[model samples]
Target: MKRGKKYVEAAKAIDRGTLYDVAEAVSLVKKTAVAKFDETIEAHIRTGCDGRHADQQIRGAVVLPHGTGKKVRILVFAKDAKADEAKAAGADYVGGEELIPKIQNENWFEFDVVVATPDMMGVVGRLGRVLGPKGLMPNPKAGTVTMDVTKAIQDIKAGKIEYRLDKTNIIHVPVGKASFTEEQLTDNFQTLIDAINKARPSAVKGQFLKSVTLTSTMGPGVKINPIKVM
Candidate 1:
């Protein structure tokens, strides 16, 4: 694809079945493809139960310095004090009870993340059926619900990227634009990997550093050697 040429080229340079291999494969194929492997871009062998099942599993999170290069629309659920705080903090959408019915009737998803205050959880809870499936639900575990509306809105605007394991226990997200320099892209990649390493779930026994690959939107993927990074 137009966005993946650089990642494809980088993968070709590795000349090994690193995480880059999956990236390269994805880049080369015309249709979207999924990669499964026992090693990470760093070439570290995955250990333990190998939660590679395409269902329940825990992965990690990453905060992309450059953000996802996509504009994030935030929906804040608050009233009075919190509502004012969100508006002052630059929230794209902020309201209370009325907002829920409007969203339900419109089925709008242009927004990326949703934030709600503790007091407003009951109202927001009513929209679980609508927001949960879209992964836009406001949950305390993901830091999407807080009393500090200012900080919540600031973090969303600051390029905070949340990652979770897919059905295959692998986390995927875009790190940069195609126009970004290799150095810039690599730095972003390293930052994400470090975060993932730090988030290793205790349930995952043994070597937690598994396989990793870097690819772009509709581009070839390249696997990086984990050892070189270790």
Candidate 2:
């Protein structure tokens, strides 16, 4: 793969062999984001837990102290009072089964997150094939499926993010934007790290967090020292 000039320049700033502390990593990530637009800073965590084993699955949500710089658009599946509540709580799009065709046939996916009421899961189930692959399917564990749509919408709008182990046992989540102050990015990164640490599965053996890397969308990854993270 041919590397871009900006990427090559940014890569020069990071020492691939060195593991940096969280604060240093965050600073480096910001400095290396040479994109014209505000680049998103993301944390890629490689864990020892195997996602294939049900017991080893690691998944949960957390509210970043400084919300992700990107605005989150929420699509809520609810009916009657719950639907009204969701709209009242600031959900971007609120509807019930009617959205199925709009999404399936029209291929509309304007929202960033999907929030569904418990009763609407049956309705949501119909669109699982479409939503699941996009990681837009609302799960109860992520607080996206709940009777309390108000809290769910509020949390998401306020920077609530779900972190789950992918097929490779790596969890990727956006911490903040490169434009954010170093302190703001560090605070969000620490909050997310604490949440992941607390969600450690009991079935995991040694070194739950095998590796952690912080990087901007277009920057070379800045490795975070796992020992310092703990």
lDDT of 1 by residue, 1-230 (tens): 35455445544544454344333333332122223221122112232234654232544344667655567899899999889989999999998898887789987776888999999999999999998777777877567889998987887787676666544455666665555444555566667767766665656655555555554444444555454443
**lDDT score for candidate 1 against the true structure:** 0.63
Error of 1 at 90 (Å): 0.7
Q: lDDT tens digits, residues 1-230, model 2?
A: 89999999989989999999988898899989999999999999999998999999988999998899889999999999998999899999999888999999999999999999999999999999999999999998999999999999999989999999999999999999999999999999999999999999999999989999998888899999997886
Residues forming the 10-long window of minimal summed lDDT in candidate 1: 36-45
Candidate 2 lDDT (Cα, 0 to 1): 0.94
Residue 209 in model 1: shift from native, Å?
3.6
What shift in Å separates residue 51 of candidate 2 from its native position after superposition?
0.8
Look at candidate 2 and give me any clashing residue pairs: none
Which sections of candidate 1 miss by over 4 Å?
A: 1-62, 227-230
lDDT by candidate, in order shown: 0.63, 0.94
